[model samples]
Target: MTTGTHSTTAAGVARPGGPGPLADRTVSRVGYGAMQLERVREGRAAAVALVRRAVELGVDHIDTAQFYGDSLSNEVLREALRPEDGVVVVSKVGATPDPGGPRPMRSAQRPEELRASVEDNLKSLGVDCVPVVNLRRMDTGPGLRPEGDQVVALDDQLAVMTAMRDEGKIGAIGLSSVSAEVLRRALPAGIACVQNSYSLVAREDEEILALCAEQGVAWVPYFPLGSAFPGFPKVTDEPAVLAAAQSLGLSPSQVGLAWLLHHSPNVLLIPGTADAGHLEANVAAGAVAFDDATLAALDAVPSRSQDVPLG
Candidate 1:
């Protein structure tokens, strides 16, 4: 797979520019998520193929994590793409899979643990220095708390990453599943992006989204298709979402991606899928255009929390 294989906007058509500030290079508004690739039916080989195809389709940003298949996704990326190829692979630390428990993951927030996570990601991706490392907050403590709940303070985590950055172990810092308040507090540390649970049907992070826009930080939303888990109502299940997709002659998922791109300049879509066809369809969603009426229809969709936000 190679860059410049295709253009999202057709000639003579007004191409929409990505909103908000990003890194120095041009990262496509649409990125590929590496989580599902780890669990693909065809396993690692299929995962590697999808990453290559995504890069070929101009997807410059690939969101990954060491916990995703115990660094399975990063390994696929290392095997598929060269580190010097210039695609931005953003990874996260702070939580790891709980192999012995029913819980999805357990926190690894200690400075030493975070340092080890960063090293694992670097080694898995075969890169000397990672472009970005997100301090994914695993929990906000036990209870129903307001936004920006901090189990582990941001300053302590950033301090460790700052030292690593100074040593050239990582490039910039980012946060995952953090609130606006937490973000404001972390301003002194400098943030490059924020990954949070947001979609047409999940709108709890509006303030966070608005904050990122105001601060010029990239907002890369995970679960953009609603929730990946079963028994959850997907974004496509919403009446307004279905109606708009039918009228616009696009799939509900495609319409969802288009809405996110139109929602804000800093909003970057990293929709993931295991199927090769689905991956192609996701890349094509970047080209799905919308006008004022369509945008309004999508905006009116009701918000519903599928489950508690994950790190």
Candidate 2:
């Protein structure tokens, strides 16, 4: 659609404010995730262009990690972004890339490791301070879990993160892959947002989502349409989702993303894609609307959780 402050649906309903407060800045709910940029086969030039296109479409919040292709994603952002662009780059820490190890990434959850990760992000992004840095806890995961010395205490991690925030190394603190109890305990630290694996079909973290909503913390779901990993259910594969997509003249993926936007006001999406068309569609998904009947039908679809092995 239009690159305005707010996006409107076909039904004429406006997305109030179009952007919400995160890390002391109001950012579009439809943001870009930079992980895919690490794997873009077209190479760095195309990846940079995709990032620029995202900014052109009014995306202000970009989520990334230093370990994503060993800081390659952040480097792409470094080449593509400028201070005048006014984009808030959010990064995560908790793991580091291991090219030769058994896994692609390994837990870096020690307090010192966390600090090094933040430093890596700052250096790679060429920023003095990260707008937001999410502390990706390995307590619960669809990915790597801490072991041996990697297992760090939450309070210890938060202490360092808060110190960084006070030192102006990071503007705000967020969390990922944490349980409701962990979030509840961490609420006093001023969590700006939470990145969790949640979707129309995989909503195991609904409690955590509700807690974030109640506490005014933005809920940024990682897999808004499920994962490609086996055992995980894709929202597009749901019959009701397909039917709704057909009736609305939108892709099943769009329908899935739209359902998340409509699910809660505090929910911010960071759907990732390397293709130009998919990038546009993900941003446009913010404006998709649904009638009450369709919304209810989509809502009625049973939520399922599958334990998929992840590194």
Candidate 3:
């Protein structure tokens, strides 16, 4: 059951995160992330059902990558959605699955490799053109790093990405895990959105977030509730956060996610989960409104840099 009692009408009033822009489409600010679908223990059918349930709950933006679960995420999306559903399907490149390697993924950052990855996503998702494709640059990482020839130039990668957009293989281009300078350079390519690690506590990417805001690009944060990584602090663990949650009659996670929404108007969330109940709570986070005192308390929770990678 969802913890939020807020409801939405046909106009999308009071809906999760309300509606925001992504590329050429206006989508629910509280969108779904399909990466965790790869680990659903309930089988593919259950995964499909969860996606459908999200759609039913007013989710229209979905963030995914071809490297996730070796394209299993795309396959599940293919089975669960149709183009007419009007959902904006977003994907990323710059890496591919490497099941037997030390890491579950390896760099495929070359221009040609990115093109191939886009083609693979097209085939797997059964779509002629993906709405948005984020070029996940390995500049600074809490994840895989590019090596040798795999370290491709941003302009070189953008050339092919722009070409694909011109060819209609991708509707728009986005960037992920990038620095402010890179985003500034790529702005000429017409960036539509950015996916970076940010949260109430993890604020190392504030410069990048500010740049995106200035450029009118959507800020889709990946780890909105911090991460499971050792050095990363969970937002729920903060005493102030716990106190706020209790006062509001909501969970700590809801308060954490709501803070992002309140922090920035352009911020969009792609909080992922396989459990049906958890999905409801995440969506309900959209309804979370804060008083000035609560907001001040959360704002004073002390920002820290998440130095460790989220992988």
Tell me, what's the RMSD of every candidate? 4.6, 3.5, 3.4
Candidate 2: what lDDT? Answer: 0.87
Q: Write the per-residue lDDT of candidate 1 for residues 100-153, one digit (tens) a residue.
A: 866655677778889999999989899898988998864332212224323556
lDDT of 3: 0.87
lDDT of 3 by residue, 93-120 (tens): 9999999998889989999999999999
Candidate 1: worst-modelled 10 consecutive residues by lDDT: 7-16
> In model 1, what is the error at residue 128, expressed in angstroms?
0.6
Error of 1 at 168 (Å): 0.9
Q: What is the TM-score of candidate 1?
A: 0.87
Candidates 1 and 3 compared by lDDT, better number: 3
TM-score of 2: 0.94
Clashing residue pairs, backbone N/CA/C < 3 A, model 2: 144-311
Best-to-worst order by lDDT is 3, 2, 1
Q: Work out the TM-score per prediction.
A: 0.87, 0.94, 0.94
